[model samples]
Every structure is written in structure tokens, then in C-alpha cells.
Target: MSLGKGNFQFFGGSKTLYELKQNMATIGQQLQKTEGELSQKAIDPTASMEDIQAAQKSRDDLKMRFDLIKEQHDQMEAEQKAKFAAKDNIQNIADPNEQVMKAKAELIKATIRQQPIPADVKQILGDRNNTGGEKLLPTTMSDQLLMEPLVKNPLRDISTFTNLMNLEVPKIAFQLDDDDFIADTETAKEMEVTGDVVKFGRNKFKVFAPVSETVLRGTNVNLVQSVERALESGLAAKEKKVAFTKSPKSDEEHMSFYQTGSTAIKVVEGANIYEAIVNALADLHEDYRENARIVMNYADYTKVVSFLNNGNSTYFAAPPETVWGKTVKFIDAATDPIVGDFSYSHFNYDLDVLFERDKNVRTGIEDFVLTAYVDHQIKLKSAFRIAKVIDTP
Candidate 1:
């Protein structure tokens, strides 16, 4: 018997391709064995009639099984071709409106190819023209196909600067201590004892995605994709901006490394940036100085490019990849030429990202709501290790 209603609709029928292939393989092996035996009997000059007859009978039985299996396999393939042809025919409609209707129906039926549009959403589809349903359908072809792809966040992979740790609870606890291990001397008193220098604290932050029912159900696929894009982009840009431009206003967040007084490398008026960057490397410790990278906004990066173009060619060899033997990252939040080992920074979160769907929670919302959120914070291990070359304003 077949499985569920439309489990194998895409495969043409409910019969699994695995089972069909296995059956064919078993039949093929039996046929090969029988053929091998028949060949052996014919090659032997002293073979008796009984042996030859038995070999012939085995070959006949195997041939029947092989033929039956081959026929079934061919039939399944034909059915698949027919099913696909029918699907294509449905898609090949001449009229644009008819094509859209067919596509919507296929989208509704083909759950694997489509994100789940809940029952509440389906109900709203008919009533999309009602009040508060202005953006009822997706505007683009590609957006109608699937969910939006995630925005790429380069900081997520950094090991030194950002710790991308998963948290099960609301806060991440850690111990801060400036005390170092003492070298005991025979003449030293009490092994250089000191007071308790350890401090305990937790990092906490709340990220919220307040999605409306109109966005979830009333709008089309393109709007849904846009909403997803906005959520991810906003999270990435805001967190990085807060880390690089704004200091932590409360205990719930970590302080920005840019705010560290000792981390700044002031540039003289009309001073060459290339020389300024070289000097800024000294601000970071020698251990991390080798891995130091330059961060600037696209505008600043372009200005540097123009400066290099007007000067010596070998001075700024690569255009976008490297500048003065160091890798350059163009971040929107970066206002100055910041040099640091960003890998030392950390971003903590829950494996279950803050985004979730809630149908009954929203009293005013009439449709299903999908809220994408993030619970995360950026931590600076050693603020002094990051140096920013600021222009005199």
C-alpha cells in the first residue's frame, strides 16, 4: 500500500525509489548467477545432460524474475515522466493570471517546496482585500519561491574578539580577576599574598522582533522575504554599531572597545594615513599586533584608495583585499581607521535564535505572526588591544 495522501507526489507515486532499485538489484544478481552457471556447464566437455538441464532451468527462472523486475522499473519511470509532464503543463499556462493561480495552488499543495502558510493565513488570502490587507501578495517571482536567505555577518566567525557562545539561560556568567600566579621565593614573606581581586558578573541583553500579523499573512512572499532581511540586517548592523560607536549604557550590555581611552591613536592634521596606520600598530600588544586588521567605512576606504592611487603603486598594492600589508574590513559602523584583532571580541546567543511564531499571544493580531529576534551581546576581552586612528576634527 502507498504511504500518506501525497507523500510521494513529487516522485510520481508512493512506491519508494529505494525499494524499486533494491528489487532490480536482487533480480539482476540472480540472473548473473544463473548465467554464470549456464556458461560453466557449456564450457565443460564432460558435463552431463542432467547438469546442463538444471543449469537451463535456473537460467529460465532467473530470466523470468529479471524481466518482471525490469518491466516494473520501466513502468515506474514512465509514471514519473507522465507526472512531471503534467506538472510542466500546469506551469506552461498562456495567461498570466491563470499561471499565477496554478502556481499558488501548486504552492499550497507542495509543502516541501513552500514554507508553511498556516490555516489562519489561508483564511486571510480570500479576505486580503479587506481593511488592513493592502500588501496581500508577493510582488516578485523569486520571492514567491522560498524564504529569504540570511545576511552574511563576518564578525560571527572571529575567534579572538567575538565569542559566539550559545546560552541556554538569559545571562552568561563569568569571573574577572587581575591576580596573577606568584613565583614563591625562599626569602619572600607569605608567597606575595594579596586581597581577593576577583569580580563576578553576568552579561545580559534582550533582542526583540515585533512582527505584525499583516506582515506575516496579509503580504505576499516578497514582503515576507523583506521582513526577514530587515530582521537579520538590523540585528547585525545595530550590534556592531553599538559595539564600535556607542558605549554600554547599562550592566546588561558590554562596553564598546572604541570608548577605551588608551586604545585611540590620534593623527596629526594632514598626516599620511599609510604612516598613521603603521604607527597605530604599536598601540596593540606585540602578540596581537601581527594579526591586527584595519576597519573603516566604505567612504573612508574609498578616500584611502584615491590617496594610494595618486601616490606610489607598491605602497597600496591590493585595491580591496589588503592595505599596507594588513587586511582591511569595511564596516558601516566604523567612522575612523580602527586597527585591532577583532577575533578577540565575542558574541553570545541562544542556539534557538529569538525569532518565533505565535498565533494566540497577540490579542489584537488577527493572523499568524512570525517574529524574528536575537538575544546576544558583544564582549571586548582586552580593550587596549584595539587601536583606532582618529582624524582631528
Candidate 2:
């Protein structure tokens, strides 16, 4: 969540976390709305004092229930931050081997977090109640620039917190041996094709069936006490509690994704993170990618860089944050040598910079991004945690 400084300063590391907080605001609003509705019902005009008090008691109980759940969500968020911080801290060791260790740790955490998506969950997620939990981009561009995706599935956001609900996200089962060891049901069921093809001289038609059971692969299951050991597994083990204070981006101005602006960084879906990062660096280095069609500020993108660090491959930019005249992306490799660098992502700028920048806090070029241009954002993710029950299963 913290950018230590320098190159890390320009990296999306910090901006991403801020946007996450932005997404959290919506959840908070929902909570407050629920509170207001409850209060209205409790203080109904014709209610007796006894009835009002009873309703008030019910409200209090509801508040506690939300608070309890909120606490858990807060804990999960804190743990996520801690895990990120730890990975970054380790990466800062300045040792290539240590850096690998940390990246490996991060990768493991990502994999472990993914472990919760049990096959059966595909069924649970399809439930009607659960469908509301997902959001989609506006039917149209929703605004001037094409800054939205066709889907609003929160789980796909690369910068958002790992979804903890319904993914079968692992939880503590209990501790044993006086906390010397811990237990969890963090197991996964993966289907694989293993039967022999039995192609005998191109003769005979044969049928094959996949086994329903799983072969035990190591789970991230670990004892709850060791931080270093936990990192060795594919899941984040760091746990903590966090209190989120409301955060709003600055009134820096605005630009839509693919609109004329000085700071907008158009992004397409399926863009590779690594590739986007390099391109952003290169774009800044080369100054601007091209002259803007509506606004003429793209000329300022003229800052040219000699090369990407560690190689002669100077990062390049594709004009208007575009490539081959298309706005959507399917891969990092598709970017022009110079065009793939800009990113308005979690690691970069966020939505409030466009919608509510008048109040949100910002750092780096994002100050320019909100004030200068509209970005073409093709990916969307929310920053909150909640569960949607289906059929009371």
C-alpha cells in the first residue's frame, strides 16, 4: 500500500491502494443507507414509545451485526495490505535472490487466495441473489471516453482486494496443540484428464470419463504462528486489523479513457500488467505518444527516454493511448514497442479522479491525469467485501 520512494514512487503501488479505498466508500454508503432506512422505520409517526424502543433495540442489534461483519472485512483487508507490504519489503532487499523469494511469496499468495474458488462455487455464484453482487459497465460508454468494461465482475479487478466471500476463501477452522499448530479446510478440487487415449491403429471408438475426486496437491495449510513460513506457502498468512477513513481524490480535473486530454492513459481489457508498466515508463520518458486530436497537449508527451532499464529496448507509446485504431486489448505483446506504457490502473489512477477528483487525494502525475485528460478504462473492480446468499444453502 505504501510506495517506499523513487522508481517505486512512480509505480502503481500506491495509487492502486487509494482507489481501493475509493471503492470501499460505496460499501460504506450502502451501510449508511441501510442505517437510515432502519431509523426511519423505527421512528414511524404512529409508533408507541414501547414499539419505538423495541425498534431501536432491533436497530442496535443490526448495527452490531454489521459491525461484526465489518470487522472481519477489515481484518481481511489489513491482512492483504500486510502481505503486500511484506512482499515489497522483501523485494527491497536489493538482492536478486531475495527478490525472487519475495516474488515467489507473492505468487504463492495469489495462488493460495485463488484456491478458494472451489468448483462447486461456479454453481453458487450463478444464483440469482449472487448475480446482484456483480456489476457491469454502463450499457453505453456512460460518458465521453470509452472508459469502462463490458463486465463488472469484481473478482477480475487486478488491483482490488482478493474477494473473500464465496470463493471458499480459506478461514480458520481452529487451533490445536495450544496454538502450536492450526487447522483449515483450505482444500481445492481440480479436474484433470488422465485416461489413456488407447488409439489402437485408428480403430474403435472409445469413451472416457473424468474422475470426480481429486489427487491431493499440497494445500497452503500452515501453522498460524510463523510469518516467514507462511510466505513459503501460496497463501498470505499475515493478519491484522484496519480502520478505513474516508478518502477522496483531488479536484484536479478530468479526462475520459480515450478522450482528448493531457494526462489520460487509455487502457484496454486483457492488457498485461508487466507490459503496461514498462510502457507507462517509456511514455513518460519519451514525453508524449502523439499529438492529441481534440486537445493539443499530447505534444508534451515528447519526453524521450534512451531505453528501458536493464535493456536497450526503449519503451514506446501507441498514440491517443491507442493501437492499430482499436481501444480494447487482448495482450501486452500487442502494444507497439513504444505505445504500451501508459496505465490508469489500481497501481496508477482511479475512477474518482474522473468522477469525484474534486475531493480525492492524489500523488504523482495523477495530479495531471485528473486535471488534464479522460482515460479510457476498460477494466473495473470494486473495493469492498460482502456475501450474497443464494437459496440459504
Candidate 3:
């Protein structure tokens, strides 16, 4: 009833596989022992008919159990082999970008379906397990989403990002010295350069987008891309509000340029928006003016365009992309024009976005909550100058 013992190998080397192999071996041994007992009973004339029938039944049951165990072991081995083969094929792709794209697509599919991401896909994307059932976007996808706002989020484009991953206490260090070099003799005393560090405060931002369960479960819809775009728009709007309109109190951490208490230069009497911007730029320190970017509302930019194109000319020309060789960033939510070196504005963010689903069983409506950690500060308040246009009474 038992097959001969042969060499056996299993993929993945998992504990479950090892235990299955042991169970198979133990069942095979029991079947062999039962067969031997049944044969002896059949040959012995002293053995009763009832005893012989019981031995045969015992042998048949053992054989059935062994067959079931063998079937399970074979199935597990085949699954592991197929997984490894697919991984090998992915690794053998010539183009690295193609490999990443393929892996990213797999991750996206898994995320949309609310299934666990494959182990190989996680390895390729350097992703961690979703222990809390919150799906984490792949690193590549997170980076793409973060940068996507740059098209409409001028603040994000101009601000500098500091990687704070694995940091217990994130901080930004800034040099306080005005001059690092001085004209001195070889034996002149060396001056000490000073600097300061600002500890980052924890700030969390969440964006929620309502998605239909049908869309999430459907194969025809591109749920990942759609959710990504929706989240991107939502985040962009929140960023504009945070960076331009939020006025933090003294006890609160300053997260917006408007809250930094930087020097505000009021527009001179009878000056146009363009002149006001120029005046604001002039007010900034010479050291910061070189890298200064002009940030204003889109409506204000239209006014500047009108001012520039007011005169009748032979050729129709659009406003230059830059003002006085400085890049101009137009945001819709800005109330005042700002001229400053935005590099001094520091932002820190988590490398991955956590996605969670909120389902309403009563209404059959589902929404996804996308969460990310972020902190922002203006390292040097003096590096910025705001143009405050006072109303004429």
C-alpha cells in the first residue's frame, strides 16, 4: 500500500512545508506497517475471519490518509515553484524600468483588489508588510504622487525636502554666519562660525476621496491611477491653504510662510502690482535676492500680464516666464505676493502613503482615506519678504 521512499525537495523552505513533508513520511510509515499486519493476518490460519477483516479495513483507511497528505504536499510544492519561476522571469528582464513598471502594476492591482501584496512584489518595491491591513503605496508610486502636485503647487516646487526617515528627532541646521571668508593675514586669528538647529514638530495630513465599491472591485477601471489623481488634487488644495492662509498662533508650530512673521513690505503709493513685486524683491537681503522666487495669486499674475501687455505693439507677446531673471510661481489661493529664497523653507514627509478603506454598509458607499506624515518650517524668516498692498481709503 505504501510507495518506496525517494528523494524529496520543496521550495521556499518554509516551516509549513517542512511539517507537511514530515506528516507525509509519518503517514507512509503507518501505511507500510498496516499492510504488513494485514498480510500476516491473511497467511496465519489461526487468525479469525473478523480479525482479518478489521486488519484489511485498517490498511485501507491508512492508505486513504496517506493519499490525502501526499496530494496537499504536491499542491504546495507546485505553487512555490510557480512563484519562484515568475520571480526569476521578472528578474531576467533587460530593462530595469520595465521591470519596475511591471512590479508596480502588480502592486497597484493588489492594492485595488484589497488583497495582500505578493511577497516578490514587496521585495521588488522595497515595501513592508501591511500588518494593520492598511495598504502602503510603493515607494515609486509615492514619489510620483508627491511630485505630481508640482504642476499646480508652486510652494512644493520651490520648497526643499529633507528626508527624515528612520530619524527619531528630525532637525534642520542652518548657518548663522554672514561671511565664512575674510581677508586676513596667514597668521590671523580664525573666526568661529555659528549655526543653529531647529527641531521639527510632528504634523499629520490626511486626504480622503470617496470611491464606489463597484469601481474598486471592477477589473475594467483603473482604480489606482484614478485614486492617485484624486488624492493629488486634494493634497494640492490642502497644501495651498496650509502654506498661504493658515495663521498659526504663538503656541502652535508655524507651518506656513504666512505664519513665519517675516518682514512685510507694503506697496508704495501709486505703484502697480509689478512695481510692488520689484519693491518686495529689493527689500530682501542681497544674499537672498539671487535665488528669490516670486509667489503670487493667479489673479495677481493676470494683472501683471495686463500691465506688461497694455501698450500697443507690432507683435503680440506673452509675459516672460521670469521676472528680473527670477522664477515666478502662481498659486490660486495666495492673498499677497511674496519674494524670497524658498530654499530656506524646509519640508519633511514620510516616504510612503497609507491607504485605508471606509465602507458604509447601509448606503453601500465606500471612501478611501489616504494618510501621510509631513512637517514644515521656515528655517530663516529673514530670507522671505511679503508684499502687502494696503487699500486706499
Candidate 4:
């Protein structure tokens, strides 16, 4: 099957896409070995027709299996394409309000599936039709807003190091040093006892959204969408800020991997993109090279893709999911490619979310105010293995 940047395929669901490629390589090698054995049989003067036929059959069987694997890979690619097209259709809808509402509904569905729905929320949503008259106490027509499940957030789903924590206390302490290690033997040397202790305190992030009273009580599904948009905007910005913010000079905020002097950094020279990527990988410490990842913006990644598509290089094979045999992630914030041991970096959360709503006696505006609060911390365990390439002409 023809493979390109857009139509890349992978199989073996639980295994990473790269691992499946390794399987294909193994199959190809076995086919080659079997074919070689058959060639030797053909050259033997005492070889019988039965021996040659059996060897040929074995090689043919391996080829068939390889073909089947390729077919499965192609099928997966087609399915992925269809999914992307469908998602695009939803996103490009003509009506802006309808588009946002649909997206918000999806998010609501996802959240409801995972957590218990509050009685008040259920009452507000279930009473959409307003079946009861003014005399009916609980079945008032004023609460007609419909609700949907939550949409799944891709960042939270795909993040390797992000985690959730449930803590009654606001702060957690981490020991930077282990319980002391073994030293020189024989003539006892003085034991080294000095180390640093860092405290990870919860930082609160708050955001507010104001909605008119008419929109809040309206039966229109768009109302939920408006609220969702405001909340999502805040949350998305917070996530990006936490992940990509440059490390600070002091302990004012959490240090990110991109900050200068925060970790190992390298400068890339020359015009060849492929070689520059290899050099970035090389800059990683030998200990973390095996697990290192290359992160770059979509534009830079597209450049690499263009190079591979040309098929001019003889140095190494380029696979769809990897470069230099390591996983590659396309991130918009990654202006320059970063080669890092991601396992050493982690995201910690003290609370998932704290949402509050106020209706009466608020600001002068005739709108309800909704506020959301989140607490989290980011910690980089080690910086020795991480490095970013500073591209220069």
C-alpha cells in the first residue's frame, strides 16, 4: 500500500504505531531469509523437487501473512480519514450558534457519563418542555434549559505525564534527595549530607463568565453552548499556560521545559532538516536518548514531512509516526523542536474544578456570574536529558 504523510496507517491497537512497524520489519526479514534458503536449494545438485517445492511454499506463506498485515493497516487509515472528515463537517457548520451548542452538548455527555449528575441540574434539564402549568410548584416553565453530556478533551486524554490528585491538604512536600546512597569503603570517607528540599504548593486559577438572565432561563440549547464556550476558553488557556510557559527566574511560578537554562539546550546549524533532527536527538543525554521524544510545531513537522516525501535521503528510513526511532509530537507552542525525556516531567492536580454560580445581588449588570477555580502544580524531576534545538541560518 502507498504510504504518505496524510494517509499514514498503523495496526495492533494496544501497541504503539511504531511497534507495529517493527513487526512488519521482522516479517520482511523472515521472508528474505526464507527466499535465500530456497535459492540455495535450487543450486544444490542433489536437491529433489519435493524439497524445493516445500521451501517455496514456506516463503509464499510468509508473503501472504505480510500482505494481510498491510491490508489491515490500509483499512485503519481509511477509517481515520472518514472520522476526520466527519469532525470537520461538524466544525464547519454554517450557523455559529448551532455549531457551538453541538460541541458543548458533546462535552456535557462525556462528563455525565463519568460522574453523578446533580439533582438540580437534572431538574433544570429534564423540565425542558415545561409540562406543568403555573400552579405546579416544581414544573415551572422558567427553567427550560436543556443539558447534554461533556465532550472529551483530547489534551487530557493523550497527555503522558498529566495526573489527578485528591488531597485534603493544600500543599505537598517532595524530597529532592533519596535516603542517602552508598559511599567509598575501606578508609571511611566523610558522608555527604547536604541536599535541597522543594515544596509543591497548590496554585489557584480562577475565571468568570457572565450570562444574561434571559439566556440562562431560555429553552434554547445555545445557552449551554455559550456557558461552555466561556468555561472552555478559560480552561484551554490555563492548560497551555501550565504546559508551555517559560521557566521563571525565581520560585514565582512553575518552571517549564522551554525556559533557558532549565534543561539541556542545543543550537542547530546547517540547512538539512533531517540532520538537524538527528543532532537534536544526539544532544539528549545518552541515558535518556532511548526514551526521548521530539516535539515541534506543525509547520516544522510539515517541513520534515516534505523532506521524507521527496525520498532523496539515503541515511535512514522515515516512518509516519517517528523520526530517529523515537516518538514525535506536534505541538503548536513548540516553536523549535525539543528533545526531552518526558517521563521526568509531570503535572499534578490538587483539585479538578470548583464551579460556583451567583444570580441575585451580584454586579450591576442583569447577568448571572459563573466562576471556576482549579488547583495544580507542575514538577520537572530531572533536566539533564531534555534539550531544545535553536535553529539558526
Candidate 5:
């Protein structure tokens, strides 16, 4: 009738061990009582051989029963060894009390191992790639604790994200004071609103494996210099494993990795400004070769012509015959296009500067963003499709 763990012989034999010990104590007490009763009796001169035989037989039976119990306990231990091993291999089942204590120790170790993530709380796995279209997965205890460091603190835990496009507005609206007030005049103020939606980071994008470092300092190394040499020679094992956001419920999931290597600036080349900007961006690219843009801003090329041809431009020469020279011209009162590039600066990130200095012109793009930076004195400002992408074999 026994089923599951209750039928185990070890637990059943444990009870037998207790009962046997109790029985042994009872036997000792009975022996003492019998000895007292025997001491009070007088010795019989003619003792029968049959009584002695009966006493000897009773002693042999008791010895045999005690031996049987000992054998049963020993066999109990042997029979359960295989079962315990099977449970350990198949499932991680072990002593429940010890397992719980070990789990607690693991929790403590995990907590201790995650103290190095204070600096990264501002950034989560999905910030780089905006994909809030994934399903949420259940996380283990370790996964949860590890996630705390991986997720940022500023925005609390986000479950779903939706990205909305920024809305553009047409023409500016202003308020003006009128001296004449009609008897029943109506004043109207129109509100022009541009849309910028706030989307969830986690819900929007899937995070890949996070960046981590694995140390391999062998105990055999005694000297720091030896370890240094090992590190330099690439003798020790090393790797950069990338991490990303969780996947969403639906298809067409976008996964992005958290990277901080370098940043890039956007270049908007117009008809007149195309050739000059191509050369400018080319120089930046020739210096850098490869880089990623955080964001790109595209302005109107017609604006460049407006700034140069408009009456505000200061002039050193006339409309059509100026060669490639650094001179000034005045048309309209608006500032020269050169000022716009300097002010807006197409490349404007400190991180771009840090990783892209000297050999790479990583930043300073924002200064070039607005066409006002160009003095507009150059003869030709831009050309269309002048900067073509040539494929090389």
C-alpha cells in the first residue's frame, strides 16, 4: 500500500532502530528485576537437566532475534543507496533541509557577485534598440537579481513599449497687441502641438546577452608579473559575449546589443552643399572609416541658398564668378551658413570625442548640422549625387 517517499526502507528502518534500542533498555530493566527475585530465592539441591536445557534454548532464541534485527538495518542501508543516486541524477532532489540552506547560500553568493553593477543601472538592455513588441519570460531567482543591475533605475520596471513618430508643425504663431478693441471683439489663440511619444524600453525591444568579463587567474601563478605576461600574450582565455533585450510575443522581433564603442554624426548634403559636405564628411570618414550614428538630422539645402543669396549676406565679390576662396559676402541680414555648422555641430557627443580623437574625427558634426556655419562666400556650395558609393572587389 506504500506509495512515493513514505515506502522508503530507510525511514521505516529508522523507526525500527528506535524501537530496538527501547527494547534493549526494557530487557536490561527486566534482568535487574529477575536478578533481585533470584537473589531472594533458596538454592535447590536437586536441579533437573530439563530446566537447564529450557534456559539454554531461550537464550539462543533471543540471540538469533537480535542478530536478525541488526542484519535488517544493514540491508536497509544497502537497498536505498541506488534509489538516492537515481534521484540525485534524474532530478536535483536531495535532503530538503540541506537543499534549502544551500539555496540560501547561493542567493547570498549571487547578491555578492552583483555589487559591481551600480554604475550600469542607468542603462538597461533595450535602450539601444527600441523594440517593445516582445513577450515577457519568467525569470529565476538569480535572473531577477541579475536583472536589477541590468535594468535602469530612472524609469521603473517597464513591461510594454510603443514607439510613436514625432509630429511636425507648419508656420509659426505669435500674439500681437492691437490698439483698437471692438465693442464685442473676439480674440483667438491657436495652439500648435507637435507629437513626441514616450515608449517603454523593455516592451519595445529584445536584449541580447549582456557584456561580461571572466577572470582566469590560476592558483599556480605566484608572481603578478607572470600574470601580466599571460594577459599580454593572450595565453589566458578571453571573450566578449554580447547581451540584448528580451524577445516579444509576436513575430518580427528586433534584438539590439548594448554598445558604447563609438558614436557618429549625421551629414545632410544638399544640391549646392553636397560636394563640400561630401568632402567634409569624407575627411571625417577617411579619418574614422567606420562609426555608428546615435541619430541623424537632415536639413534643407534650399536653406543654404537662402542664406547666401538672401540680401543679408556680406559680399567680397558678385553673384556668379567667385572661385574657391575663403571670402565673405553679404546678401540678407541673416547670419552666414558657416555659423550654422559651427553652432549646430553635426557631431556633438563627448563619447565620440573620447574614442575618436586624432586618427578619427569622431565628433564635431553638430557644429556642421546647420548651414549657417558656412560663410557662403564659396562659388558652388553643393552638387547632387556627387558623393556616390563605389563598390570594390
Candidate 6:
């Protein structure tokens, strides 16, 4: 099967895909070993015919299994391409509103079966052009995908999001040393401002949602909503993971808060978690402290609660809505408590998501692939601070 940039074909779910690939590799190795054994047995002067036949059969069976897997993988790719082509036909619709719902329903039905794009739908989308069959999601659909993640992730509420189309964005920072009133006619002094450019579009991410045949084939199911919900959940989780964790590879561009070389504030000696958080807030620059909010894992919040309640099991207090006079956000991806004005952290992505479909013939499951180009930058490092607590004996 041919794989292109942003277009990957895999059989079954991600884990199953890995296992399938490993199985193929093992079978190929065994086939090669059997071939060597067969050659040796065939040439042996004292070897029996039965021994030679057994060796040959072993090699043949291994080869057959390997070939069968390859065939299935190729078939799945072909089916995906066909479905994509059918989906593209829906773009011809002139009215944007009509196109959105019509295309959604047609695509969902096409995913369940290999039927052709409806004649009316095809006519509405118009003829295919010379764009190599690549198309962006409609405006309404794009908005839905963009807003859906906010519902799934609390981090989205605190951070700034921009639909950036350019490769680089220039950030200007100005510091005015004098704002005092002077004589009305007095000349104002010019102040020097600093500016820097941050490049974007360096990070690429993909999210996949696999649907079982049973769910897709259900007559009473709202297929469109079902597929959308799965995609939304997958995208939300992947985005949060990327935003909070550092990339394993040093060479790759990572917008994670835990980027290497980032400065972290240590918890003061003899301070509790709540006090540590308060100290972290005090450490932030005064200009950013007013807008600062706190983010940490829920588990860490539970530890704070335990400390507050003196570890009493019967007298549990409800989780605090605010910590240190700032809104507290919980994300499982957060490893340490971060106190900062997250508005300075910008997350940017293309307004469109490329959608593709693939089916695992053996398992009767289909995976919806959503590919997006995204990049993020913390415009001002000093605007945020991470708290690290150290235990002492």
C-alpha cells in the first residue's frame, strides 16, 4: 500500500496494526529460515523424501500467511481511496448550508457501505477539479470541530487560540518607563520596544477513531453523530497530550509546557502544597499575576485535599473551585502545577481537518483518520511558572 504525507493506511486499530506488522515480520523471518533448512535437506545424501517434503511445506505455509496479510492491507487501502473519492464529490454543492448536512450524512453512509455518492449529492457538489482531489472542510463543519474540543478539554478555556495561516508571527513587546502627566505642550520622549518573530506550522499531529462494524451497521443509530463524537473525543485527548508533555525527540519542535530548559520554581522549605502554590503565584511577574491561573493533575489536587483535611476519611471536603484566588484547571496530562497567565500561550492550527477512512477486512472495523497541522508557542516565558516540590528527610 502507498502511504503519502498526512495519509497513512493501517489495518485495524493502532495496537492491532502494530501487532499485525509484527506478525508479518515474524512470518517473513520464519519463511527465510525454512527456505534455508529446505535447501540443506534437499541436498543431503542421507535425507529422506518425507523430511524434504516437510521442510518445503513449512516454507510454503509461512509464505502463504505473509502474502495473505499483504493482500488484505492493500485491499483496505483501495477501499479507503474509493470512500475518499465519494466524499469529495459532495463539495460540489453550491449552497454552503445544504452542503454541510448533506455531505455529512452521505459520508457517514458511504463509510458503512461501498455505495456510490448519491446522484443528487454529487450534482450539488459539482465536478471534480485539478486540485488532486484535496478539499477543506466546509465552514460550518470546521467551526464544529474547533469548538467541540473546548467542550472536551478545560485547557482550551484558559489558552489563546488563533487560526494562523502564515508560517511566522511577529510578537512585539513594549515597555513604557514613563506614563506620568506633563505639560500639555511638552514633547513626549520616545521609548525603545523589542520585537521577535516566532515560527509556526512546525508541528503536525493526527488523531484516529476506529468504529466497529456492529455500531456502524445499527439501523437505529445516528451514524453521523456517532462518528463525530468519537472523532471529537480522540482529537481532544491527543491535543491535550501534545500541549502538556515534552516531546521525546530533542530535534522535533515541541510546544509543550514542559519543554526542556524551561525554568521551574521550587516549593519553599516547610511549605504545604497550598502554600507552595501561593508562593508560585507570588513569583510570577506582577504584570501577569492578575491574569494567572493554576493548572495541575487531579491526582495532585486530591493530595492537596488530603493535606487540607488532615487525611481524615470520614470528613472529606469538596474540591476547591479556586486555588490562591485563581481559577484552577485540572488536566491529567499536567505533571506539575503551573501558575501563569495562559493567555500568553498561543495554540495555532489550520482551520481545516483532512478526513480519511480505512477498513480492516479481517476485523470488520473502520478507522476515521483526522489529520491537522498545528503549532504552539509560549510568547512570554516569564509570564508562567511551574512549581516543583521536593521531599526532605
lDDT of each: 0.48, 0.28, 0.65, 0.49, 0.26, 0.64
On lDDT, the candidate that comes out on top is 3
Model 6, which residues run further than 4 Å from truth? 1-102, 111-132, 167-195, 217-221, 247-253, 262-270, 311-319, 391-393
| Reference-based lDDT, residue 146, model 4 | 8
| RMSD, one per candidate, in order | 21.3, 34.1, 10.0, 32.1, 22.6, 20.2
True-structure lDDT of candidate 2 = 0.28
Better of 1 and 4 by lDDT: 4
Instruction: Quantify how close model 2 is to the true structure by its C-alpha RMSD in Å.
Output: 34.1
What's the CA error at residue 216 for candidate 2, in Å?
A: 40
Ranking by lDDT: 3, 6, 4, 1, 2, 5
For candidate 4, what is the lDDT? Answer: 0.49
Q: Please give the lDDT score at residue 312 for candidate 5.
A: 56
List candidate 4 stretches off by more than 4 Å: 1-199, 210-214, 219-222, 247-253, 262-273, 285-287, 311-320, 357-378, 381-393
What TM-score do all the candidates reach, one by one? 0.42, 0.18, 0.62, 0.44, 0.21, 0.61
Indicate whether candidate 2 or candidate 5 has the larger TM-score. 5
Candidate 5: C-alpha RMSD to true structure equals 22.6
lDDT of 4 by residue, 1-393 (tens): 333334343434455445656767888899999999999999998999999999999898778767766666567667778888777554556686565444434334323233433334334333332433211211221111101114322234334322234433211133235443322221012112212322344555654555665554554485665665665556556655655666533552453545554232335433565567776666544645666666667777667777766776532355635556877776687666666556544444432233334433465323222232333232232322333344565
Please give the lDDT score at residue 120 for candidate 1: 34
Q: Which structure is stronger by TM-score: 1 or 3?
A: 3
TM-score of 5: 0.21
Alpha-carbon runs more than 4 Å astray in model 5:
1-48, 89-284, 287-289, 293-393
Cand. 1 TM to true fold: 0.42
Could you tell me which 10 consecutive residues in candidate 2 have the lowest summed lDDT? 236-245
Instruction: Please rank every candidate by TM-score, starting with the best.
Output: 3, 6, 4, 1, 5, 2
